[model samples]
Structures are given as structure tokens and as C-alpha cells.
Target chain A: MAAAARVFSEKGFGGASLEDVANEVGMLKGSLYNYIKSKEDLLFAVVRPDADELLMKARRLSGTDLPASEKLRQIARVHVEIIDRKLPYVSVYVQEIAGRGISQEWTDMDREYMSLIEKAFMEGVEAGIFADDLDVRVATRCFIGSLNWMTRWYEPGDPVRARAVADQLADVFLAGALARSRN
Target chain B: MAAAARVFSEKGFGGASLEDVANEVGMLKGSLYNYIKSKEDLLFAVVRPDADELLMKARRLSGTDLPASEKLRQIARVHVEIIDRKLPYVSVYVQEIAGRGISQEWTDMDREYMSLIEKAFMEGVEAGIFADDLDVRVATRCFIGSLNWMTRWYEPGDPVRARAVADQLADVFLAGALARSRN
Candidate 1:
């Protein structure tokens, strides 16, 4: 999967050949087919772990008894961590998801996880933990967009920068960037 | 350029053809060459306006006598408004900018505009108009990422929704989502 991700990242999903992936992993083309059905399948195989990890994190965080603010903070951190850990796969996922032949299962999983975040915003607003007038859907997307954008700039193995970005972004999402006194 | 942008948005950059763009604009493929050198040239033609507009806005706003907060607010609105106005071209720009054949001119322009935003953050901090501890580069990218993500969801011709998104996002960038009372 790692080799496939590297191949797809370098040559886009349409441009990458299954043989290139096989070469990267030291497998013969025929042997590769034994493990994956097609190039599309190989692409999905590479990205599924990212989707699974995200859904796993979302479910676990949302299932906890934390307040909405805390939940959002955790969500933000976990999201950054996932992207940091799976940079190659996530990059391919972001670039290719809108293309033809992506699985419905992937889209369904994405929707489910997004709903969990939206639910968090709704709960936050209802509990007076978030602004009452907040548009939960757009706000949820704003939060998601902020974190996902990290993929374009976040470097792998830079734990210091990673932690700083996660903490700072979480702070912004929960409390805005304005100093407390100014607010 | 408009016809090329629509074609590129519908078909990924690699998939789009000069013939397709020519057909959209009611011209012959051979005639398109009279104006564009290649498919890649056509892409740069379509996206150059967005880059030019961004740098133009950034330079103009950064030169203003407005406070950092006001400057940032206007920057946010203008940023979103441009994406709203040029959705198809901007969408192609986001997807293809990192690819192999993209023009250096585009990347240089993008970096310049981003640096302008980073400068805004730095000035804001120096003037005590923003939090003292802000990481100007990351914060600026976060701001850019938030606005750029609108290309994914901002529906064209829906002025009402566009205005709401712009205002809501600007508010978040300036003050964040936490209620002032909570702060």
C-alpha cells in the first residue's frame, strides 16, 4: 500500500500504471493482480487505511463523554495526526477522490465521519458551549477545511511543527485567534 | 479562457484537450494554437487571471492605511469573493498547481501573495493588533487554506450563500468561533 501510494502520488491515479506499483514493491505484475483486482482497486487499497483511521478516530472521540469544546479539540488533533502519519496516502486521497471509479463505500465513510463532527458542533451549540447562532453545517465544514488544508503544507516527521500546528489550530477553532482580553 | 476553464474543471488537467476547449469556445483546435502554445499553456491562460487578481488584491490591501484587523477582514472577503467569481478556474488551479507541468510564474505569484498575507500577520502581531504568539506563516496558510477550500463547496450564482460564507469565515479568521463571553 505504501509503495502504491508513492506511485500514485508521483503519477496521478490516471497516470500511474499497476506495473509501476509492482516495481516499487518488488512484485511481478501478475503477482500484483493476485493481491489486487485492478488499478482502481490498488488505488482504493492504498487509501482505505486513511479512511478507516479517520472513521475510527471520529467514532472513538464522539463516543466519549467529553464536552463539545474538548471533543472538537481532540478531533482537530487526531485529524492532524492522521494526516501527518499518512501523508502520501492522504495526498492521493485528496487529489483523486472526485474522479471516476472511486468506491461508494469511501464516500459513505466520509459522510459518516463528517456527520460526527457536525453532531459535535450541534451539541456544542445546544449546550451553550458554542455560539447559539452558529451554522453547524458550514461551521463543521470550516473546521474540516482548516485541518485538511494542513495536508498541503504539513511536513512528515516534523513532530514539533505538527504538535504546534495542531494545538494552535485547535485553539483557533475553539476560541478564535483573538487574545482573551481583546475579546 | 472561460471556455478553457469550464473544460478543465470538468476534465482533469491531464484529461483536457485543446480540441475540447476550442469546441467550447466555438473555435477550431488549430486556431487555438494561434493563441495558446499547448494544453499546459491553455491551463496557465485560464488560471493566470486568478493568480494575477490575488497578487493585485494582496498588494493593494497591504498598502492601505487600515488597521491590521480591518486589512485582514477585507483580505478575507476579497479572497472569498474572487473564488466565488472564478470558481471553475480556481478549482483547476487548486488541483493542478502542484503537478509537474505547472508554470513557474504561477507558483512564484502564489508564493508572493502568500508572503503578503504572512506579512499582514507579522504586522498585526508587531502592532499588538493580533496575538503576540502567533506563528505568522502557519496562521497565514490557515487563513489561505480556509478561503481556498471554498472552491470545493461555494456554489456559483448563489449570492446569498456566498455572502454568508464570506462573512462567517471572515469573522472566524478575525475573532474565531468561541463566544466573546466565553473568552
Candidate 2:
């Protein structure tokens, strides 16, 4: 899966060949097919773990008895941690999900993951932990819009800086940068 | 350039070929080559106009003697308008810019465009229009983050809906959705 992710990241989903993955893994093309049905299936296998990891983390955090604000912070922290631990897989997931004419299964998985985040926002708003008037859908999108782009700039070894960025982003979404005293 | 944008948007920057653009424009590849040097050059041409349009619009609005609030509103409006007017080109730009091994010229152009946006945020902060504690760089990134993602979901010929979404985003960024009276 790691070999497949590197090839996919370099050549893109449409451009990558199964033979390249096989070469990287030091296996013949026929032997590679023994383990994976097809290139698309291989792509899915490479990305599925990262997606599962993200979903699992979100579920575990939501199961906690914390306030909505703390839940959001946990969500942010978990996301950063996942990206740090599985950088290449997460990178492939981010890049390939946006491609046109994606499979229905892929689209379904994308929406399912997004719905987890959306539910978190809705829960927060209802709990009065986040802004009451917040458009939960748009806020959810904004959260995704901010966090997904981090894959483009984040360096895995720099966990401290990544945490600082996550905290700043959480603050921006929660209280905003506006001076509270002025209000 | 418009034809090239369409081709690039439909079949990503790396996926698109000069022949495809030529076919779309009712010209031979040889004829297309007379106007542009390569696929990369054609992409640069398609993207450069929008950059110029955005920077020019920003400058015109900021150069106005209006108050900072109105200036910020105008900048947001211009950004939304660009998405409406040039959705395909903007989509191509966002998708292509994130991948591996882009040219230095392209990188410099991207930085230049980003700096233009950062300048507006800086001006707002210096004028005491935005919050003092607002990190101008992060604020600028947030704005771009919000605006750039619009291309993903915005439907063409739905200007009214687009405008509403844009206004809501502007409100979220400026006043936040925290029920301001309570705040």
C-alpha cells in the first residue's frame, strides 16, 4: 500500500500503472495481481486505512463525555496526529478524492466521512458550545476547507508547529480573531 | 485560452493535451502551437488573465476612499464574482497547483497572487479595521481557503445562490455567526 501510494502520488491515479507499484515492491506484475484485483482496487486499499483511521478517531472522540468545544479540539488534534502518522496515505486520499468521474463507492465514502464532521458541528451548535446562529453546513465546509489544505503544507516531523497551527485554527473557528473587548 | 481552460478543467492539467484544446477550438494542434509554446505555456496563459483580473479588481476597490469595512466587502464581492465568471479556469488552477514538480515561474506567480491578498489583510489590520490580534498571514490564508474551495461546489448560472453563499461567508469571517447581540 505504501508503494502504491508513492506511485499514485507521483503519477496521479489516471497516470499510475500497476507495474510501477509491482516494481517498487520488488514483485512481478502477475504476483502483484495475486494480492490485488486491479489498480483501482489497489488505490482503494491504499486510501481505505487512512479513511478508517480518521473515522475511528472521530467516533472515539465523539463517544467521550467532553463538552462540544473540547470535542472539536480533540477532533482537530486527532486529525493532525493522523496526518503525521500516515502522511503519504493521507496525501493520496486528499489529492485523488477530488478527481472527476470517481467511483460511486469512493464518493459514498467521502460523504460518510464529511457527515461525521458535519454531525460534530451540529452537535456543538445545539449544545450552545459553538455559535448558535452558525450555519452548520457552511461551518463544516469551512473546517474542512481549512484542515484539508494542511496536507499541502504540513511537515510530519514538526508536531509542535502543527499543534500550534491546529490550536490557532480552532481558536479562529471558535472565538474568531476579533478582539473580544471591542465587542 | 477559454478553450484551454475548459479542456484543462475537464481533464486535469497533466491529463490535458494540446490536441484536445485544438479539437475543442476547431483548430489543428499545429495551429494551436503557433499561439502557445507548450501545454504548460497554454495553462499559464489561461491562469494569468484571472490573476490580473483579481489583482486589478482588488486594487481598484482598495484604492477607493471608502472605509475599511466597505473595502473588505468589495474584496469579498470581487472574489465571489471571479468564481462565478471563471469557474473552469479557477478550478483548473486550484487542482493543478497542489501537485508535485511545478515550475519555478508558476510557483513565483502563485506567491505574487497570494501576497496581493496578504497586503489587503495587512492594510485592514494597520487601519484598525480588523482585530489587532488577527495574524494577517493566517487571516489571508483563511480568506483564500474559503474563497478557493467555492470552485468545488458553486454551480454555473446560479449567481443569486452564489452571492448569498459569499455574503454568508463574509459575515462569518467579519462578524462571526456567534449571535453578535449576545457577544
Best candidate, DockQ-wise?
A: 1
What are the lDDT scores of the predictions, listed in order? Answer: 0.77, 0.73
Of candidate 2 chain B, the 10-residue stretch with the lowest lDDT total is B174-183
Residue-level lDDT tens digits of model 2 in A1-183:
999988987776666788989999999999997898998799889988778788788888777878766777678777877777777787777766732338887777667656777777778777766677777777667666767666666678777866877766666666554445544
Worst 10 residues of 1 chain B by lDDT: B98-107
Interface RMSD score of each model: 2.7, 2.9
The residue ranges of model 1 lying beyond 4 angstroms of the native Cα positions read: A26-31, A98-103, B19-31, B98-103
Model 2 bad stretches (over 4 Å): A19-31, A63-65, A98-101, B26-31, B61-72, B98-101, B123-133, B177-183
Cand 1, B chain, TM: 0.89
Candidates in order: C-alpha RMSD to true structure:
2.7, 3.0
TM-scores, each model vs. reference: 0.90, 0.86
Q: Score candidate 2 by lDDT.
A: 0.73
